[model samples]
Target: MKTFTLLQEVVHIPTKKKGQVITTKVDREGKQMVEVKYENGTTGWSIPEALTNFIQDSVDHTGEFLSD
Candidate 1:
């Protein structure tokens, strides 16, 4: 499990919001999926690649930026 903040708003997953990725998994079809916990207490599944700019960084999760 890990946390992540979006670089921009994604409106299609129930609402246009920002959230932290709580879990990552590979489905039976071999596709990568991520479970995100929105700021509003909602959870949804999406592909990591689907996120516009979801990049991983070695910096602290508490930091404001996830990438350069």
Candidate 2:
């Protein structure tokens, strides 16, 4: 399974809120979705691609948090 752990905080576009990407998975539509735990303590899922404006290309390190 593919996944990612964002090293820095990012804004979830749909909510226009800043949060950490605590988890990720490929959803039913085959989109790489992120489950963000926002600063408000609420969580939401969305494709990180939409937040590209601030999330530079290098920060997207797939499976970087996985363990053996």
Candidate 3:
């Protein structure tokens, strides 16, 4: 299992709201997933592909933050 430590995905949400939190991870099966984790511990999820594209575009724009 792998986990990303930052709320980088929150920026990708088009709504642009603050105070929201998310937790994204890769399960043992390697499927990419995102969870909207709240301060209260409840959560929701989305396709990591959206984040993949967001990161890709950012890298293309600034040539930074590449991952392996």
Candidate 4:
């Protein structure tokens, strides 16, 4: 897991649905962040670590994916 402090304002994010494949970009320090644009034309930011734990937990329960 990684963390970051945003240096600049994000301009856009593509729409994403549940279970959709999304893209993440990391800074030089390896902080994982996702850029998302909302329906109302607002950008949203999220850290992968915030969701990684939950996803890993779910996968662990179902044995569908492996977590390290």
Tens digits of lDDT, candidate 3, 21-63: 3665677787867765544455566554333333434564555
Worst 10 residues of 1 by lDDT: 1-10
CA error at residue 48 for candidate 2, angstroms? 1.5
Worst 10 residues of 3 by lDDT: 11-20
Name the weakest run of 10 consecutive residues (lDDT summed) in model 4: 12-21
lDDT per model, in order? Answer: 0.58, 0.68, 0.49, 0.43
Residue 24's lDDT within candidate 4 is: 62
Best by TM-score: 2
TM-score of each: 0.53, 0.58, 0.34, 0.34
lDDT of 4: 0.43
Candidate 1 lDDT over residue span 1-68, tens digit each = 22234433433234546677667677998877777777788988887655533333323577466586
Candidate 2 structure quality by residue, lDDT tens digits, 1-68: 43457645677666578777777778778888888777899987767764433356436667558678
Residues 14-46, candidate 4: write the lDDT tens digits.
323223214468777877777544345555556
1 or 2, which is superior by lDDT?
Answer: 2
